[model samples]
Target chain A: MKADQTLDCIGLYCPIPIVKIATKIKDLKTGEILEVVGDDKGIKLDVPAWCQATGHELLGIEEQGGEIKVYVKKAPN
Target chain B: MAKKEKLTIAVLSGDLERALAAFMLAVTGASMDMEVSMFFTFWGLNIVKKNEGTMKSKGLMKKMLNMMNRGGSKRLKLSRFNMLGLGTWMMKDLMKQANMPSIDEYIAMAKDMGVELIACTTTCGVMGISPEKDSFRSEVGSLAGAAYFLSEARKSGVTLFI
Candidate 1:
């Protein structure tokens, strides 16, 4: 999937990946998509949960070679 | 716009792992755009002390308690497998390799993210910890009673006691 920006959080653990995503998402325009790439298994659950809790949209998730990729769309306030 | 959700965490343990969990949750809650507050009481108060070693206090009992506990985030031992501090050292090494922030770093991150750190007044009194005397971390914004924590917890979507 195409994303407006990408954030690589490989080698980081839970909360760090999510924190990076949250911080990076702020730099994008509303509705712009952010692709978060990480190896932390926790993100598979955290990304969707965080997006759901914060009013963002989780577009999709992909996993290849043990790395997980999550796509989130910024929410309109 | 909707009001941000609130997250209140009570730090009740001085264990290194538990302290890490508390700060991790605090920072994550704040990163999720929630207003977060951490209430420190009893043994948990050690996590916010400015000093890591034997604290000066009046009376033999208070001095002994402070000396044994030595309240500080960096001085905390693990709840399990402490191995006379070896386990904690290993844990810290692993965390550093994994890019996990240290307890002090998490505290800094929480403060920068505007997470409120509140020290319990009752615990302060019982443990002879005086904020006015610089016993507590400067990041601690308030010294409050249980009523303050209860009110904050009542309004919070997530309230956890660690």
Candidate 2:
């Protein structure tokens, strides 16, 4: 999916990046995709858990060259 | 119109830096018109103590050690304290000099701003920290556990663990 907004949370640990992403997503319209790039190994689990808990849809997750990319689509409530 | 936001922060570290971060976030959230709730657990509960001495300052050497070992203030992570009293004193002084608000001020601001403060019941029970009749701001509420805070956090637009 094409992202309407991209967020780079690289170098941030567990809760900071997640908090930042959540705050960002809250400001976006439903169906807008937020692409998150981070280097924290825990983001692999943190992002998905946050999406699941918050009712947002995690479109995809990929790791390349030591960086993890997450695509999340804001779900309309 | 801009929609109102909600943020719930679970601050479980007992470290002074983490406590300051939690307070800062609480203040910021309130300033932004966000409904904010903070859950204090584990060592984080120390800040909610009735006694003024609960959040004290430490010595320079210990402060330096904490900075070196815990990655400094911006990290907002915990530092291991061999002697809790001295460390707390040092931390309180350092935070004071840095213009960081006291726990009392944070709680008062939170109260005036409608921020919720929830102490972790289980941690308090296990650690023998009492919350009853405390000087904790009148806005402070009863204790809760991780599950309670997490459930509340799940409903918030922003949830932070500091």
Best candidate (score: lDDT) = 1
Quote the positional error of residue B120 for candidate 1 in Å: 0.6
How would you class the docking of model 2?
incorrect
Error of 2 at B98 (Å): 5.1
Off by over 4 Å in 2: A1-77, B1-3, B52-99, B130-139
TM-score computed on alpha carbons, candidate 1: 0.94
DockQ for every model, please: 0.85, 0.03
lDDT of 1 by residue, B6-115 (tens): 99999988888899999999989998889999999998999998864456567777777776777787788999989998998999999999899999999988998899
Query: Which candidate number has the best TM-score?
Result: 1
lDDT over C-alpha atoms for residue B86 of model 2:
65
After best superposition, candidate 1 residue A47: deviation in angstroms?
0.5
Q: Lowest-scoring 10 consecutive residues by lDDT in candidate 1 chain B?
A: B125-134
C-alpha lDDT (0 to 100) for residue B67 of candidate 1: 69
Q: Scoring model 2 with DockQ, what do you get?
A: 0.03
